[model samples]
Target: MSREAAAPGLGHNGGPPLEDPDPDAGYRAYVWRRAHRKAWKTPPPEIALRRLARAEELGMSYKAYTLEILERGRYL
Candidate 1:
């Protein structure tokens, strides 16, 4: 687990934190989801869509639409 993950749970005094799913399992599915999932750092889908629509209103092509967003996103 990472430090950011620990701080939220660390506020617990002594007895126990909120609760762990299991001693060994430890929120297995939840952890897996966090590990595998990715999120945008810059413009999100809604923002991108708005930009695309505005660009199209200006008559940008499909290639140009994609090109404009290419630099704005990290490769998946």
Candidate 2:
């Protein structure tokens, strides 16, 4: 089935919550998802390649290091 054909929250736990939209942030998010998907598609950047290299030297994969930095909110 197509992604759009699927429910937004189907298979998420029992299913989508039966609640009404917030009417404020909900519509904003809908528009943002459609208009800005490409803008947010890629990873932030590789300006931190030097840091990534260090992580690699220390036996960490780039993916792991990137996630760690982002999780720590230190995207340096």
Candidate 3:
């Protein structure tokens, strides 16, 4: 075969072509979600109250603080 024909995926795109966007994408997503649930735990109400207080002290709303924790696993 010609070089171009042999090199079906070689181009500016810069990687092997996707035969499937995801072969086991569903399984992978399921595993990731399971792990995430295992890693994240809800804090007790008192801890939540302290976090709210700290958020107020930092001039941030409680909602913003909780969202930050959910996104990053900690408040910045």
Candidate 4:
């Protein structure tokens, strides 16, 4: 049998698995994650209190309400 048939796990090319073809993909993903977390940082105490009140009135959890605002850029 050929090398490819000998090691099916190495893929059809018979090379190591190409889980991440792009070398810069990891750094880009890390930057994206950092930005995403920054966007969801805790609001100020007064704003948090207001959002909590509004969330309670709307019968939604604080996290759900906040996620709605973050994703839709609007108050619900």
TM-score (all chains, Cα) for each model: 0.26, 0.38, 0.48, 0.67
lDDT of 4 at 10: 38
Q: In candidate 3, what are the lDDT values of residues 1-76, reduced to their tens digit?
A: 7987766564456665667487799999999999777645567899879988999998998778877877887667
The candidate, 1 or 3, that scores higher on lDDT is 3
Candidate 1 residue pairs in backbone clash: none
Give the per-residue lDDT of model 4 (tens digit) for 1-76: 8986676663367667758589998999999999899878988999999999999999998999999998898888
Question: Which runs in model 1 stand beyond 4 Å of their true positions?
Answer: 1-42, 62-76
Candidate 1 vs candidate 4: which has greater lDDT? 4
RMSD of each: 12.0, 9.1, 8.0, 5.3
- After TM-score superposition, the amount by which residue 5's alpha carbon in candidate 2 deviates from its true location, in angstroms, is 12
- Model 4: how far is 8 from its true place, Å? 2.0
Best by lDDT: 4
Q: In model 2, which runs have C-alpha deviations exceeding 4 angstroms?
A: 1-18, 24-46
lDDT of 2 at 53: 75
What is the alpha-carbon lDDT of model 3 when measured against the actual structure?
Answer: 0.78
Give the whole-model CA lDDT for all candidates, comma-separated.
0.60, 0.68, 0.78, 0.88
Q: How do the residues 1-76 of candidate 2 rate in per-residue lDDT, one tens digit apiece?
A: 9987665665577655789767699788888788566433455457456766778787888767766765686744
Whole-model lDDT for model 4 versus the true structure?
0.88
- The full ranking of all candidates by lDDT, starting with the best, is 4, 3, 2, 1
Measured on C-alpha atoms, candidate 2 has an lDDT of 0.68
